[model samples]
Target: MSIITLSPAILDAQADGRGIVALESTIITHGMPWPQNLEMARQVEATVREHGAEPATIAVLDGTLHVGLTDAQLEKLAQAKHVAKLSRADLAVCMAERRTGATTVAATMIAANLASIRIFATGGIGGVHRGAESSFDISADLHELAQTPVTVVAAGAKAILDLPKTLEVLETLGVPVIAYGQDQLPAFWSREAGLRAPLRMDTPEQIARAHRMRAALGLPGGQLIANPIPAEAEIPRDVLAPVIEQANADAARHGISGKALTPYLLQRIFELTQGRSLDANIALVLNNARLAAQIACRMTLLT
Candidate 1:
């Protein structure tokens, strides 16, 4: 009756006290198309290994929470149809139903924390959606960071969200939003979001130390490492602003809301960008994976 299934590599990493970076599964199941998603998953895991850390891609497969999937398992998950996208609210229910599910940031943090894995890498964390006064729309990813002890590395909040409001909410929740090597926060595909991050750390050592200090102080929340997307791969904010606006408009026109809205907006943006947005997404994810691995390695050294 083991509820959690750790992959052989993950178990070995835990036993050897090696650095292990937890990766979320939503990117494979909800973020991209099939073959490309599979390819991206392989590349992200490879990048983590290349940077001297083991990658533990978290997902739920047949009622089992897997902390690092084998190649065949990854392939099957990638090709599987109609997998539930699990967040904190639905992860346990999906498991109880014996349904396969992909982990969102919240669920991934929960799983990583449960497995004692301290670092996670993702494309971007979700945040306050536009017009929150009326719709009260927000993402659970922010709140999860406020309580989960896993350090999350990302290109920052997805550009589709209200960046300023997201930052405000993170501050309210007492989460440390550290911009990696920069003053301005990154906006997913773009390098700058036109707002200042609350904190900045130039090296992985600094980030690792901060994470350690937080635990030493008995803090409840985790650290957010806002790693910017590579400059060469960025789509530029001015160019993407209108694309995001148009995508949001389209989604609203179609009466999309809640969980269904993100994919719909992303799809419209992808169509508007002529596939450039997806390429930037892939590049940023690889970049974040690299940074996350470096931080994880540093964490092990600190220990």
Candidate 2:
């Protein structure tokens, strides 16, 4: 009858009314190499703590929806091979099958909502993949944002996705895409995606208030805080354009599709960009974690 499971630490923190930020586990199991992924996960959690918030990295282990993970559990999950990358569609199936799976953006949002965690931080969100019109390869993260109430802070949609299409879909679904201190929407590694953002909000207090206002207005979905990568860390759009084009071309040439395309494109982009892309990704995620933690703290005071 248990609908959700909580790690002892998270349960204790929640009981005390501490601000807790929910993180996705797929970044560990599917996003990076073993030691680096584990280390990055630890660093992100620590970043939240340093900003006076508790970190609840969500996942499903052995059929249980874990609201948070222990250090040992994080290590095991980071190193475990062949673990499933779960989204809204297959999240239930993974639990029913009693298998281990890392929560993607959508699944993480679902787990966060169930646990009453309001904030989530990630590198970037998945979106309409190239050729989605024909392939229907839209990410469940889009729909999850349309209905889930967890506020997500990320750089932007992954640069490899169809950015214009992603924004269009978000608009059509009534999901607010607020660019933080910027006029243009950020592309994952780059500071600007060359497209005007739908909304602009400069402060965490403002962002938190917007979330409250959404509830007051009976808005069903969450908001997207498009926090840009640090200026110095960005790869610049022009420089990254050809790189992304090349990666996309290679993906098409190889006929990679579905879930495999993202990882493949990322790895190839890392190679083509000489690892600058990964460096930028880490920077933006940490930046978002700090901002999300601040917002969560403000939300606690406001609510």
Candidate 3:
């Protein structure tokens, strides 16, 4: 396979030994609204910098895979309408078509591996959706985690999905799920998903060591660091339960399925929660970015 071209900004960071954290672009194009999406993208990068690491926001624009983006690029992407949400299946097709694309978790992981970036931070990863048994609607993220060699720090799987089933899929795929500071897994907007994590690592160094160990053992896939949302920022499972149920019901009633399902449910949840869900979502992402940077810094020492 041919190499994917990266922006000069990302090239410099990778060469300079600065702890580089990979960020997905879908959050800018599909995860949030215009100005706020642009703002959040910048804030997440700034947060990584403040924590002693450089941020590489990955996306595909006009046939080019950008490992890090400039402010102009970020703004352009945030406002651009109908940009393809690129993932493992269509990443190369979009690049071949010379079209603009926002990298989802799987696409971002592929780009991160190409750029030799070891750590990635994102809000939440997609997984086995509810009723996936018949629909067969599993997210590409689970398979990507099983093959990509980058450490992904997220607030667990998105709360809208079946958390236990997602965990089972990860376990079946041989991916490690390490819950940070807590034994229970996080449920996106909520701090606890009411399920025990497969592994626990309390510090960045420990996480970094695990990454190193995997590489030493010649493991092919990455580890998931389930960093919980802050207590103050969390929506609490009890409070989120009813909201999620309502959102799921709304999706079913409206016949929303596949890719449309997540965004639809999220928007409904935002409305249902009076926008509290969006607030909590932003808080959790920033929290994950900070921890990813710390782990990135530790990995840098090894390199």
User: What TM-score goes with each of the models?
Assistant: 0.99, 0.98, 0.98
Error of 1 at 175 (Å): 0.5
**RMSD versus native structure for model 1:** 0.6
- What is the full ranking by TM-score, best candidate first? 1, 2, 3
Q: Root-mean-square deviation of each candidate, in angstroms?
A: 0.6, 1.0, 1.3
lDDT of 1: 0.95
Q: lDDT of model 3 at residue 97?
A: 89
lDDT of each: 0.95, 0.93, 0.92
In candidate 1, what are the lDDT values of residues 75-154, reduced to their tens digit?
A: 99999999999999999999999889999999999999999999999999999999887999999999999999999999
Measured by TM-score, the strongest candidate is 1
User: Whole-model lDDT for model 3 versus the true structure?
Assistant: 0.92
Cα lDDT tens digits for candidate 3, 133-248: 99999999999999999999999999999899999999999999999999999999988999999999999999999999999999999999999999999998999999899999
Q: In candidate 3, list every pair of residues with a backbone clash.
A: none
**Worst 10 contiguous positions by lDDT, candidate 2:** 1-10
User: Model 2: per-residue lDDT, tens digit, 83-147?
Assistant: 99999999999999988999999999999999999899999999999889999999999999999
TM-score of structure candidate 3: 0.98
